[model samples]
Target chain A: MRPPLIQLQGLTRTYGRGDAAVSALRGIDLTLFSGDFLAVMGASGSGKSTLMNILGCLDTPSGGHYGFESIAVETLNQTQRALLRRHRLGFVFQGFNLLARTSARENVELPLLYRGLPAARRRQAALAALDLVGLSDRAGHTPAELSGGQQQRVAIARAIVTDPAVLLADEPTGNLDTARSHAIMELLTRLNRERGLTIIMVTHEEEMAAYAGRTLHLRDGLIDRDSAEPDATSCC
Target chain B: MLLNALLLALREIRRNLLRSLLTVLGIVIGVAAVITLVTLGNGATLMVKQQISALGSNLVVMRPGQRLGPGHDEAGAPAFRREDADAIAAEIRGVASVAPVVSSTVTLVAGAANWSSSVTGTTNAYFAAGNWTLAQGRLFSDDEEQAGKAVCVIGQTVRAKLFAGEAPLGNTLRVRAFGCEVIGVLAAKGQGAMGMDQDDTVLMPLATAQRRLTNSRAVGTVMISLKDGVSASTAIADITALMRERRRLTTAQENNFSLMDTRQIAETLSGTIGTMTTLLGAVAAVSLLVGGIGIMNIMLVSVTERTREIGIRLAIGATGREVLTQFLTEAVALSACGGLAGIGLALLACLGLAAALNMPFLFNPGINGLAFGVSAGIGVIFGYMPARRAAALDPIEALRRE
Candidate 1:
């Protein structure tokens, strides 16, 4: 009876036009409910990244209906979409796209700054966000001064600072070593379990995919497989 | 929001410090050079004007050729004499004082130093008519004028050359083999409004100068002073009528002599200098425009370099307006800083040059303020394009950029 946090029906995305037209997604249907962890795995050019871009509201679907919390994305303007992304969606990326010169706390405070919060409250919220990602001690350090894993954690803090409804990660561990990757995954797992946050992630690694509660495989822009992760790994 | 944007802008600029400085270099030079040039131009103008003001704001000059057109029997008419001075004073209601001067160049000798100098023969009215002050001794008296006393008053330049830093007062300086005691020394008057030396003359009784120095009784010019609140037109008309009647001019004939103000010469000089300053300022102003273009060029490059950064800020919840304001603020800050630097440099240049030349130094506050404000404006105008581009970029495309 409860509505899904994200709904997609009959999604199609085509790039270019006419002779050069290529369908990146074809007739896709998906629903992501609250407290769900979904990992999409695909080879290169499998349209997984394109789907992620669409799902994250970074790109518009060529033909589809997408509702986030029952609100249609198609109705939102660019600014409104950005506002929606700011207030509701969090992002984690393999590259850890942190602002080059800013300290970690300032970086986390950026979202609140956009919210037009006063300086003091921004500081408190940013500190809380940093504490959530266990980057409290390094809050004053710039991205360049931090390690790759630490920088990613800072990026996560920035994302989670607004208390967004959904967390989207694209190849979140692609750039990290196996140990660092596992550590990041464990952190994400705790956030999901303790906060009941919805997460949609993309990766090609089976081990990383195995950490998710369920998985979907994309091949040539179409869904190929959808299954629950093995019981042994799901609880962990 | 503005403060947040400012913090980010400052941080971004800090991240690429060298490049940002290099980019703003043209603006810096342009602003500084403009302020310096404008300040110097205004100072030079003021220097001339100050000389004018020192001559006394109320003083009026009467030159024969400058007023009436030359030609006719009166063209070579003898200069106005003492009788004319008496008539102007007695008949013209506004006439406060009047003096006749007979001037001629003569060779003078004092010790081993000999220099050609101007010798002026003037009445006691010369002091009040020209608004002169003594630096050392006394001006010629009425008895001295009536008796054609051989005493002379020396100017600072004349004393400098004749006496060589020693006080020339009470000393005799020879003119044409006749020695006249320097009873007084006029204060250092520097250059007049017309850029002519006002301190190279020796003054004596008009009768003494004509009878002894030049061997002629013909006068050279008339100097007139007016009472406060009297219109120059009223004094001019009265003098013209009295002089014409004195000269016995026919009713149809215009007066031959020029009765003018000291300010006319200043007006003429100032007009000339103003034109020259405008021309020079135009050349300097072109550099400001070039500097603006330089800002635009650098800002465009910045927008490109920070495309992804702009996207990040947008994604972080900054409105397009906020991004726009940030870029604009950065531009303005660059310009404002450049303007302040320019003013400092201009002041320094002015001080150094003014000291070196020993010229009258004047730094006009108005010009300095205008130069500073314009420099800042140049930043805003030129930096607008790049800032708009940065603010207008699509968040998705920006974030998607590699």
Candidate 2:
């Protein structure tokens, strides 16, 4: 009976103008309730990344309405959108963009730093987040010193440190091997199932998409198919 | 937010320690040059003023020249006579003493030591006019001066050269054509304002020197000392009028003598030196500006190099202003560190220079503080462009950059 956490109606995104204009997103209509684990699958240039960018509040749609918990996302200015991203949305990139020279602990503390939390509290929360991602013993290691799987774990720790409303992962295992990729996917599924965290992931792997409760397939910036399980509420 | 930005900036600086040091070197040299020049210049000005004052406070020299600067036509000017000196001493109310001098370079012999020295012919009032003190023995008596007695006062240089550590009070030293008894030893006055050796001269009565050495009644210069609480300008005006009247010069004719105030000369010289210092300081400030440009250049390169990092921060919810503050803070810290190092280097250099030049090491806190403030300002001014550039970068585009 609860309202959807995110609702997108006729969403559209275009780059440039006139003859040079490239329409990245034609129109997308989607809805997802709280605690939902959704996977967005598309080939390169299929606009899945564009859609995820909009969902993360990192980019705005050229046309359409996006509402997060009844707040109009399109009406917010740059600072308001930044605040939305800071307090509500978290992102994990494919490249695992951890600060190169910084330790994993400090990397995780970054979000709390932006929140203006005190140093001591930020440290405790960052350590707890690292523990959650199973990277507690590797807190002192930098990105260069850690393996790809461990680095991705640190990135995931950074994302969840602020306890945001949703975690947005874009090809979170793109750079890892099959074994590490399965491990990371299992970690994400565990976090979703155990903690009931809302996660929207962009991945092309069918196996990765299978782990989510629902799957949305995009073809040429339009939703080709939506596979929502009949008993999604029962799983939650 | 500020504390976080500062810590980030410090960490980034430490990350690129070599580049940061190179960027700061420009500022260091600029600030050090400015401070050293200013401090040394101040000390030199003080030294010159002191030497000029040592000539005598409230003293004036009248020379027989119609022009002020060098290469003047002194041939047509009438020299002062003994009566002219006496008349000015009697007529001028503020006059303390007047000594009319005639000087000649002569070789003097004492035992096996023969040295070239200046022989000055003057009255007993020469000591008062010159503010000279006697280290030992008394000045020639009034009776001796009136009688043109062959008695002389020897300065410290002449004493050291001719006396050679032995007592010279009753010793006889040969002048140009006659022998004279050394009645007194003048205390040392070191070097004069014009770098002349003040203690390499001998003094005797004007009449005595005129008869024995030159046989000329014309005095080359007249030294006048003013009494305490008397203004030099007023005394000069009175003496000028008295000299004109005594010389029988009409209103249509120009006076043949030039009056020089030691205080005015000191002020003009010091003013010139002060202007030169400012000029040097300005030139040195240019280096600071260059240093600032270096910072901006390095910062721009850094912003470009860290595009991905900036994108990460932006995606993590850092505002453009926050990014600006971080980069600006880094630039300012770089320049401020350079400023501090420059100040230290300047102090060390100034101490060494002061010792080498035999001048006092003068600390000017105002200049030091100004240099520091300006160098920091350089950071803000030059760093803005790069910081703004970094802040303006699109997060998506930046993130895509390798």
Pairs with steric clashes in candidate 2: B122-B206
**If you score just chain A, what TM-score does every candidate get?**
0.95, 0.95
Fnat (0 to 1) per candidate: 0.47, 0.55
Worst 10 residues of 1 chain B by lDDT: B65-74
DockQ of each: 0.48, 0.68
lDDT of 1 by residue, B322-383 (tens): 77888888877766766777677777887887777655567678877887788778878987
**TM-score, each model?**
0.87, 0.93
In terms of lDDT, model 2 sits at 0.91
| Interface RMSD for candidates 1 onward, in order | 1.7, 0.8
**Per-residue lDDT of model 1, residues A1-236, tens digit only:** 88889888988899999999999999778888899999999998999998998888877889989888978997777777777887888888777888887899988888888888899999999999899989899999999999988998998888888898988898999999999899888888888999988889999999998888889898999887778524423546
Worst lDDT run of 10 residues, candidate 2 chain B, spans B65-74
Candidate 2 segments whose C-alpha is farther than 4 A from its true place: A229-236, B66-76, B211-215, B244-256
- Please give, for residues B1-402, the per-residue lDDT of candidate 2 as tens digits: 898888988899899999999999999999999999999999989999999999899898888878754566688888889988999898899889999999999999998899999999998788998989999988888888888889999999999998887999999999977999999999999998768899999999888889898888989999999998899999889988988898888999998888877898798778888999999999999999999999999999999999999998889898888889999999998998899999999999999999999998889999999999988899899989999999999888898898
